[model samples]
Target: MHSDRHEPAPLRVELAGARLAGPAPVPTGVTASRPAAAVPHPTPTQPLSPARLDTPSTWPRRTLLRLVGASAVGLPVVAALAACAEDDTVHPPDPLAAQEVLARADAAAATAAIALAPGSHAALSTIATERTAHADALRTEIDRVIGVYGDGTTPVHRTGALTVPGPGGSPVPASEVETASAQPSTLDGVRDQLVRSQQSAAALARTESGYRAGLLASISAACATQAGVLLT
Candidate 1:
């Protein structure tokens, strides 16, 4: 084997006071890559606080809640205003005394009509006289009730018609009245009218006295007896 000679290791070179050249030369087969200019590091963005992140979305909900609250408060106030508007138009003060007076007058007029019929007999006349007393008593009572309550007059009026009684509350037959002597027929007609009058008078007595007064009960009994007589 031939003797191999080893090359001595390259000695360290030291260049005293030597300046580094302009651009370092690239080594063969190695690319020279310049370090990109340092990219400016942007200041780290502050983390979005929860309050700020949620505030924008919650604003509309908050506005809606306020609107709902205001509507709830205002709805009843609006209803109260409407009720006040209706009350202003519907109510008015009225009189109670005048009604009593008118009722008394009506009873008086009805009694007079019964007493003044042409064919009225003694029995009928007696009932008319009692009805006249009833009218008078009613007038006094009305005055008393009215004096206790009020003196104002109401706008209401009576609308029904009144008539004297005939047979079974019907009109007398014209042929019978014209052909027959009026004396007997008049007595018969008045008898029937007397029955109706007594019945009506007894009813009035009950209404006026409420069956509490001895005088009214006595009058009612007498009227009922007379009604039975006239019917028989």
Candidate 2:
């Protein structure tokens, strides 16, 4: 036999808040209408637009970068200025001082003369005498012209030291010559040096006049004679 009561039908709804058309009182704020679609939030990896950089905090960061960039551009200029200032304080030595050149020549002759043993070489004594005379004549000339006796000293240098850049090496002490020469006897070395010195002095003499030129030519000739004596 069939059941006396029929089973209740299932409730039908289009959405969770769906309601029937009956005039039941709706809630104050809530309604049976569907809620609006959700809006997407900005992602952290997305770049900000130029307009977004108008904040005070952003301006301060940009200003710091500008200052850093300016300093980077200016540093090289400052360094170059400092280098030029340093260069201005330093000066090159005067190369045209006749007193200096003559003084060096005197010192060179004196050094070799002093090294020669007494009576060992008569020619050496003559060379020594001539060099002494040359020094005196130069001093007198200097007194006549510059009115002052220059520093009558030579700067001591190493053996075979090429102090100045020229075909002839600068004259040095006898002991320094011995140190420089490959052989035991430095007579050949001395002769070669004297020849070079005379040649250089003769070149310098062309620029002079009066007593100075005569004296320089005489000295150059005497040095040549001394070099010849060493060969004999």
Least lDDT summed over 10 consecutive residues: which range in candidate 1?
91-100
User: Which ranges in model 2 have alpha carbons more than 4 Å from their true place?
Assistant: 1-120, 148-185
* lDDT tens readout by residue for model 1, 1-232: 2333433222212222123334555689998887889989999999988788668677899889999999999998787566545543432211222222222332333344454554444555565455456545544554454343133543232222233223465534323322331233333454444455455444544555443244345544654554566324
lDDT tens per residue, model 2, 25-131: 66898767765898988867868788887688789889999999999999987875665456433333222233334434533543554454433356655555665
- Model 2 lDDT vs. the true structure? 0.55
What TM-score quantifies how close candidate 1 is to the native fold? 0.28
Cα lDDT listed for each candidate = 0.45, 0.55
Candidate 2 TM-score over all chains jointly: 0.39
RMSD, every candidate, angstroms: 18.8, 18.1
Per-model TM-score on C-alpha atoms = 0.28, 0.39
Highest TM-score model number: 2
